[model samples]
Target chain A: MTNFVQLILNLLIFPGGLFAVALGLFLMGIDRKIAARLQRRVGPPVYQPFIDLVKLTRKEMVVPGTAHLQAFWLAPLLGFAGMMAAVTLIPIAGVYQGFKYSGDLLVLLYLLALPAIALMIGGSASSSPFGAVGFSREMVMMMSYELPLLVVLVTIALKVGLATGGIATFSLSEIVQFQLENGALLFDYTMLPALLAFLVFIPGNMGVVPFDIPEAETEIVEGPILEYSGTGLALFKLMTSLKMIVVLGLAIALFFPTPLGKNFLVNLLWFFLKCLVLMVIAITIVRTSTGRVRMDQAFKFYLRYPTVLALISLVLTLLQR
Target chain B: MKKLLQKIAKKSPWLYRINAGSCNGCDVELATTACIPRYDVERLGCKYCGSPKHADIVLITGPLTARVKEKVLRLYDEIPDPKVTVAIGVCPISGGVFRDSYAISGPIDNFIPVDVNVPGCPPRPQAIIDGIVEAIKIWETRL
Candidate 1:
């Protein structure tokens, strides 16, 4: 009874549902503001995303006539629910303990792919030609980025596990515990390459400017989401926001789970600060300065650089072990 | 509750453009106002959406030609309810230079309900922006 209630609480209140959504939307607003400023334009207020959400909820939702009704409706919900669950499993050094069990990281690995899968499903089910184009591009992108991501995860697991005298720890909590006991992986010279690889992977996973080919509005007419409007569109927006929190939170947990002090409030603030810095470095500046890469170029770039960087880190870790 | 939602929902008005078959003059002005820093509409919480379904304030450019009238009406129908249409150039409103051409199909307002008209052979950037502001006002009431 207690476990079920706790699980519900974990999914709904503290780290995942409301809190994650709020934080993610806020971050998105900040990103937009910063991007606009960088281009020397006055952007919308930071509460603009919130306003957009309210507007979306109030507007009418239109589904394409020829589309598969069930899949079209359920895709956004699937992504939203998956990200909510994934957030519950990510531990923040002093503030949260995460799901402290073996194979939680592996579970997160699979769960992290759900949004992309949901996008593909939604796009293909919409039955629009643009959606079909988007579906194929998204599938290729998933195949390309998942490699470096897998390598980075395995490299971190081995580096931590070997240092702590084990094979490889798939438990995220244990990885955080190990890092907290020692120093953060951010300061470790050997882990820097892996960190860089993960940083490169961030924009792709988040679907920001340079990596946003699948949903390129100018080219494919918003692609997968072209047919969605109102509440259904709002769900997709909400899903992306939660995804931002999950991805940024995951990066913080994997690379630098260090606490500033014993106070919960101070540490929580510090956690947000780190997330802000990570967002600025990995997402905002990169998105603002770069143009969108062609599908083939992006696929090659991810496969070549990040995958190799992560592989290098893995090889180093294995050699040291 | 409905009133409160409407009040807040007025901020974001996603814009979509349709070329009725005029030349590209008005389209350039629209793009410049939205994309260039000098006349950024994003400050007004306006975005240029790629799809009609995602649009709120529709910007219709060009004069309605005989060939594209059916397509334009179909696209307009796709933009689910409570949408405001802004006829961008003089072409859309009066057919501008192509007033009596066999290819031209009268004025745009003959078919669709135009909420705002920014008139010129191709309206100036300032005029286009003003039309957008008026469209926003009309759009707020609809929301």
Candidate 2:
């Protein structure tokens, strides 16, 4: 009887890997549709992302005569692997696929860095002037955003530490469990600054609007992926979709309350509802706002504003204790 | 039967704009017309098609300058037919600022029988939206 129960638990966890890919793709589709609707135009169907990937995968690889074909090939694969590793680390629906460590938050952050770094290296190796300029901008963008993001993570962890009697839990699963037991962070007055940090982090993490300087379509011709085509392009696109889902999951885990469900499907539904609301808000702001600041302006804003907010939240976390 | 379905599917007229030589004033208004709490073009079932072949209406802006003329014509020809062309902005309609320049090829209508002409130095978003709506009505009438 115990063996049968263990087998059932294994079945439940294995499907989550596949589910992460599907959920990621779906969130991306909705982001496009919502962004389009916000612009007052009908956007592509949600399935349009899938169609694009399929088409790109079938297309022949184009290698520019002057470009490093090897780096270009490896970049997308590294990006995809990094994101998959992050997803596997996240304990979604209380089911993790194999690797779940107490120090997984550190692993998750480093894994998240891989996609952008891969793009930077790949773009710089392209030997095109446009690619070089784009890679330079991407490097500056990474520097600016990651500082505020790290500060925000520390602030949240600080709050969780206070609530749980100074245990210093960095595991995402523990953080969510804390919220489930003591109500969501949004309900706590001490967490208001952290909430604001979350609001900034959402768009900044996705590299959309006000912060999308790296891929500003008008200024840069599609940015870091400008030289990419065929399967390479498809992998980059897939990483984008997966990245959105991962960020949304983090937001849901951090701020929103997860309701108790009688079954696995019901719990998944509840989790998705919290995630979808967070996603819609992020995408809507991107679509409605049309200000693309210079790289310096973007750098100044994130460092001064969100980074400061995260610091204040950390202080507040202490006082609330 | 698949071909017929594709043809029917093509008629509702999804458009994508490409600015070859025009001032960006037109692109600004075009973006605004499609944003929320405004005209809400999504309700119309028309979309901003990303590629030319997927689009039924190719909205061309700006005068035909020499450097961009080849690229523009190639993009225009790439659109699969049962398609309509709309000359947007006074520049594309009558070569506004660029007329009589050595680089220009004159009004867009000279090369393509424009299904619609939206006239303005750089037309207002509403005017552009209205022109596309009118084009759709004409398409429905033909159907």
Candidate 3:
């Protein structure tokens, strides 16, 4: 009973729900501010995303007459719920131990695909031509990125499993525990390719520039989300921010789950700082410096580069064993 | 609580642009206003959104021509309620150089209620920014 209550609290109050949302929005705000500065412009305040969400709630929601109302309404909630669940599964080094399950990493792998699936469902259900186009592009992007991500996860799992005298361990806690006993995989020369592949995966999964083909504003006018307004739009924004936390948090856990000190609050802040640094390196800088790529080009790029990079790590991990 | 939300909401006003078949001059200026660091509208918490549904302020450029009058009106209607419309360039107001042309159908106020007018053949970026500021004020009242 106590465990159930703790799980609920973790999912709703701390580390997963409220805390994750706030941190995600803050990271997004910082990304925008830094991007603007990169372009020599004065950006919106760091709290701009929070204000935008507030404004979205006040506006009227316009549902397209042609849209499939059920799917259109349910898509955002599906993605949001998935992220909420995924966040609880992530261990926060010294602060939180995460959900203790043997195959939590595999569950996370499946959960990570939920938002893209939500996007595809929403786009197709919208009944707009641009939405149709977006749906196809989004599916292709997902397929292209998923292969590399699967390889990367397997590589890490195998590396840890072999080192700890097993075949493969899909438990996130075990991965963190191994790292704590030894050191972070981030410093491991063999894992560098996987790390780099994960970095590339960040922007693609987050749907930023060079990989924002599915929601290309210029060509498709925001595509799948074009028809969403008011509260529906706000939900989508919240989902994206939550996704930021999940992806960044997952990256931190997998590669470098090191805590600063023994204090819980200090470790929590340190984790946030790491997320911020990772966001800037992987998402912000890449987005600011690059332009959008064609959907086919992006598909080809992901397949050729990150897949090969992750595969190299997989091979190296196997060879090391 | 509603009042507090409104006050906070007033800070963000995503802008959407509609072209009513005017010459590309004003469109270029709008682009400059968005792209150039000198007249950064983002500082005002204004984002140039691609979809009308996401817009809080509609920036309509071009003289409404017979070709695009229906399309422009439809686009304007697509924007959710409590939106402020800012007519950019004299073309939207008097149809500018196209006023007497048979192809022109504007003086856009006839079709859509324009809340602010920045009058010029092609208004400078600063004037456009000023017009957007005025639109934001009008938008706040509606919220």
lDDT of 2 by residue, A1-321 (tens): 996665444333343335666777777777768777666566667765665554454334555568887887888888876776566555555433233457767777888788788788777766666668778888888888788778777877878877778746677777777887888888877667767777777776677877777777667655667667557777887777777767777776777746556566676777777777787776556546767778998889878987888888787777777
- DockQ-wise, the better of 1 and 2 is 1
DockQ of 3: 0.89
10 residues in a row with least lDDT, candidate 3 chain A: A118-127
Cα error, candidate 2, residue A269 (Å): 1.2
- Least accurate stretch of 10 residues (summed lDDT) in model 3 chain B? B31-40
Residue B36, model 1: Cα distance from true site in angstroms:
3.4
* Displacement of the residue B73 alpha carbon in candidate 1, Å: 0.6
Candidate order by decreasing TM-score: 3, 1, 2
Best by TM-score: 3
lDDT (10s digit) by residue, model 3, range A1-321: 998899899999998999999988988999999999988999999999999999999999998899999999999889889998998998999999987889999999999999999898888888899989999999999999999999999999999999999999999999999999899999999999999999999999999998999999999999889889999888889989999999999999999998997999999999989999999999999998999988889989999999999999999999987
Q: Which stretches of candidate 1 lie over 4 Å from their true place?
A: none
Q: Write the per-residue lDDT of candidate 1 for residues A124-177, one digit (tens) a residue.
A: 989999999999999999999999999999999999999999999999999999
lDDT of 1 at A303: 98
Q: Quick one: RMSD of model 1?
A: 1.1
The residue pairs found clashing in candidate 2 are: A38-B36, A39-B34, A39-B35, A40-B34, A40-B35
Docking class of 1: high
Q: Candidate 1 chain A: minimum summed lDDT over ten consecutive residues — where? A: A55-64
In terms of lDDT, the poorest run of 10 residues in model 1 chain B is B32-41
Angstrom error at residue B32, model 1: 1.9
